[model samples]
Target: MIESMTPEQESNKPKRQFNNLVNNPVMEDYSLRYAPQSFRKWSEYAVATSALGGIAYLADFAIGASIFVTYGFASGVWAVILAAVVIFLTGIPIAYYSAKYNIDMDLLTRGAGFGYLGSTITSIIYASFTFIFFALEGSIMAQGINVYFGLPLPWAYLICSLLIIPLVVFGMTLLSKLQVWTQPIWLVLLVAPFLAILFKDPGAYGAWTHFTGNAKGGASVNFLSIGLGAGVALSLIAQIGEQVDYLRFMPEKTEKNSGKWWTAVISAGPGWVILGALKQLGGGFLAFYIFGALGATLAVEPIQQLIKGFGVLIPAPFIALTIATVFVFLSQVKINVTNAYSGSLSWSNFFSRMLHWHPGRVVWLFLNVGISLLLMEFGVFGFLNTVLGFYSNVAIAWIGAVVADLVINKPLLKLSPSYIEFKRAHLYTINPVGFGSMFIASVLSIIAFFGVLGSTAQAFSPFLAIVLAFVLSPIIAILTKGKYYVARPDALGHSAEEGDTHALNCVTCTDDYETPDMTYCPYHEGDICSLCCTLEKNCHDMCKKPGVIEVSMRK
Candidate 1:
């Protein structure tokens, strides 16, 4: 019996039973699948625009305003510049890898060393990224509502939070079109008022340039304040997850389109930060202008404050109120939709990975919105600076680990997997590499945020998170010897060395997925589609020869 076994069989390597699950293209979307050439469909321009569209959150405006009030325009300016630089530099590698390979952030994390189970924790973090920002953006919308219709902030919060459920339920297809359509209108509304104001009063620019408002530290350029402000803003760094959420649709790269592909990826991936920074600067400027005109300091209502700025453009009181409300509504709509979309995907990924059962992304949309609603009702926006300031630590840690894996660990030590391995059946439950890096960075950064570090360092905790994560990832990967990357021999499907692009099929759902999405599912005793595999809850992964990372770790 043994003698008859061929080498492939003699090795006792597991073969998938439900091949249809892995091949289904419609259900999976390469969520937990390998990104094959065929699945990467959208053009470069589409991906970039989709990514840039999501940055339309009003949090940037509020954040810039807060920084301007707390520090001066100079300090706020510096912080925005610094955060943008860091975001762009880190985004380059992440965007390049995800689009080049056509995997989502969750999938990328698997190959980056989070392993199968290990990546679950990151899922929560990533999910939080969506919901947290959703709350922020929703709150902004609520503020607009209160100003426009005299609605209570709480009711406004509920309205704003609940509205996205319908929009996101349709998923990427609707989202892409929505972004394309709204982008042009939002851009015009966003820029036109400011451009008009500048033309109307060229001297306003002069005043704005030199105007230093009520700075607690005496309005002088304080490096610590600047760094701290930047740290809070840097919380948005993990926003790349939202970007990659769309970029998985990017068209395949080839000799004919390689340059265009890379350019699109960068613009979509990290290039979003450039526009975000500009928007943030405008927010700061607007906040500054409002404060100057009011001849007062410290306004809790950003909308109320912003309304004053809009008054400078439109002479009529009622018309100006309407315009300001419209601007805020547009900004919030652009961002909250993205927030809901990304959150739903992240929540779907998280629970399915944990419970092995997926109801659908649409279900998670409600969950994500529910979480945002709670945060909104809890009045998290009241403590806006505090929440973002604390969150920046964790966000930085997560993004830092990701950047380290993509830019530093993968290239420097060769510990990174040759190709992205995102299928649940293909990776260890958890790998110490990404997890350890994130843990260490988060812990240290939290300490810094809490003032364990000195004042300046505390304000600049995000930078510290970046440094620590960047330093720790390669060391852990080298120490782990890349053992935990894959749980078993059969886990690695298709040779990446053959080429970067390939096609795959799902066993369940009977559709074609990317090679990355295709995985042998032991639960159904067949190759499972990424979506079913993601939603699967029964088998408990019986394919790894019974003693891989789980056993290794317990020992």
Candidate 2:
């Protein structure tokens, strides 16, 4: 018969010594485990505002301008609206699940159907989103620097890249304060250009409605144009991952705080797209307003757009340029901090699972920023449309698969487990349901995007990814009977309830964690934390093997 290990045996095993960066809760921020209730002490408003602050990025402006320049007013505007609707709808379930479970997108993905190792691929995809957009945002900042300070693009790129590192190193403890404090100033600058246009140049709006840059159909709403435009806009679907990075820190909900909790989740969660869509439209209008003066190539640049807007309000050219540069700098810092922060989390998840060792989240922060710096040096902004358009296909498919598992499989079909099981000991290495569906959908969509299925199919390729992933996830779950989700039952046999804040001390790490992060390790014959379970190389998953003796938690 199986029996619990004695304390003497547990103490005889070696204890892991994490570096100071990983050991400090303020800096570590539970990058690889559940956000226990004790750590989620921030108010709902504070968390929501910090999450919302990440949307200060100017990529929406660039995307809007790019689409409108390529496809015309009617199709571009409609595409922005369409993409926002889809993003908002899909974001709802993901945000709710992440907030309720107190897990980041990576942890949630592991349980949502991708399983333990299956999420590694999605981690790369998500990390790609961070760096790709980081480079894009950093490029915009470089452009402002080049225009105003007369700095070379290379130097500007270095400055922009290095500036975010200090801000992000401390994780949420510092980030929450930074984001909340700067939000007001960022908001004012965000709307300054539009407000200037409304009062100083009202006729620009009329001209914007009629402007058509390179579109063959002029201002007409062509179906192909709408499809292609929406594809680029939808590349941002993975942004929900960054939002939930903060949402995971949400305080536990209760009858008293229920209203504030839901409000924070919805507003800071999917509600981000509402502002994002507006920014896109605003970007399109600004691009149109300045096209005559700056021509096509330079008009889409946010710095140029803001300069022109500020020029209208402030008659002095020098003052206008100074303010515009300041605004651009502020915006980039706000969003790039988030990009670097989220990228570190994603890279941590990827490397820890792959190598069975984690240096720390802070180590990966430099890696993420360094990759973005390289891209900025090479001028990724020049190929903006091509880059984002192609990326949307794969991103939407991954998000679609995760959403299907969250919304359809768990509740309606009752195929997946009701509560998330992210701990490695209780989950299989891979589950075919989400991983398979996403893979198939991404491959087919990429093929279509490359015009293998002809022009119309190519234009609508992202839609193909979304439909196929959503439809296939439930079907695959039913076919597999959901056996791949959990490798073994919880050894403690405790209820997988969200509100259970009871803490347990891991014998290996010698640290106290909430019950959800603890699991029985048959190899060590003791309870282990999720981070320790992930880093254990010797166990070889002995606890999960069939006919292996069950190890119970010590009383």
Candidate 3:
């Protein structure tokens, strides 16, 4: 029996759909999938380099410097080390998950316990992570532009915000290429200033290490100082999201490539702190040297301090300015592009899950920039130290919860979901496990920060956030018996709640995915991969209405 062709089929038979290279794994950079085996063509070195490049922002220097100035050398140094250790340990599991599964951080959060709608708060947290830092890096860039071009502060903000747009529009593809190309140049400039300073006085950093200024306790290593310093340093804990964006592209580990895979993951993941710690120490050292050499009255910002530090190495003043300008610009460019790239991905995940609408990453790209611009206009720099100190608590809380899931809950009680259950059709709306826990942590920490819990508690807000979020997630998961975390088996794959090999197609990008990543999106009225399902605007979550545990609870 012959099947008759429908009107839609008859009209479209002659049309050739452009892959737009859409299905071409390289161009799209696995934007919609879990970096299927067919993709991940880059070498281990390239992947790690690309990943490392994302952390090249000048904020590390700025943060380190500010901590030094406010907390003194002992407090600042201790804080950097403590924060680095926290970030590195937490980073290990996150990097492993992203690299092993080839999924982005948003998808990872869903599988960990946030579920469909639940994971979204993490997206906002992550998006806020990006923009807050974006404003920071942009502020540094704007400061440089203002110094060099004599531009108005607002105009500098505009240029700093606008310059990175072209680079971030194509997302990871352009970023990977840009990062790869600039690696050597960035590396050279990063070291040149330090090398010159060292050459000028071999004993400079040595003396700087013991230098202390302004703090009432001096370098006596007081407990209050260390706690505050740690809180300040730990504020950058959210940087893991940016790392996962690149880790998603790591080639699937096989016997042949296992060593390289491990190497890449290590170098790009926790290894980010190697540079971060160094920069912090370097910034502290620079502040000491600059204050000593140029006198304490100069009152320069950290970025400007670095510029001047580099400028001295060039000897000829104008050429020194040019070199210093280029170094700062390149450093900001490298990091700001990453800030914008991660921001777009996060905003895309956030709004898509909440509103079920994704205009495109490019749209959120502008939104991210716009937010940073607003922060600049509001003069966020004035409160930078207080803000970072306060933010560290929430950041630590969020990352700590994720770390707890990865470490204790996943193994001890088997409470963690066995595989990442990211698809919309297969999970609850709000797990209450991650959502409820993080919300409680953030709320409590914020109150403590405002001194409702008193000055001692206020100083330890970051510690409170980390300890509370970590402790509560497992308690909630166990009390609830991990029921809200998953309502049904993730996919038609296995005996356990692990994913298997039922293949399906996306609605927008129209790519096939393993059953684990596919969802029945009502907007597309078909089975679409989670990424495409995420990108579609009109769904209104009709598919999950009956399934979401939150709705059931209200009913």
**Per-candidate TM vs. native?**
0.89, 0.97, 0.88
Which consecutive 10 residues in model 1 have the weakest lDDT in total?
14-23
Candidate 3 vs. true structure, TM-score: 0.88
lDDT of each: 0.74, 0.92, 0.74
TM-score of 2: 0.97
Candidate 2: count of backbone clashes, pairs at least 3 residues apart or interchain: 0
Ranking by TM-score: 2, 1, 3
- Encode model 1's per-residue lDDT on 292-411: one tens digit a residue: 555433343556655766777778989888888887887788788888877777776787777765555666778888988999898787787788888888777777777888776677
lDDT of 3 at 328: 78
Per-residue lDDT tens digits of candidate 2, residues 443-522? 99999999999999999999999999999999999999999999988877653554566888887878899888888887
lDDT of 3 by residue, 201-305 (tens): 788777766777556787766677777777777878888888888888787677998988998898798889889989877776777767755654332355567
Worst 10 residues of 2 by lDDT: 546-555
Which ranges in model 3 have alpha carbons more than 4 Å from their true place? 1-33, 292-300, 494-503, 506-511, 514-516, 519-526, 531-555
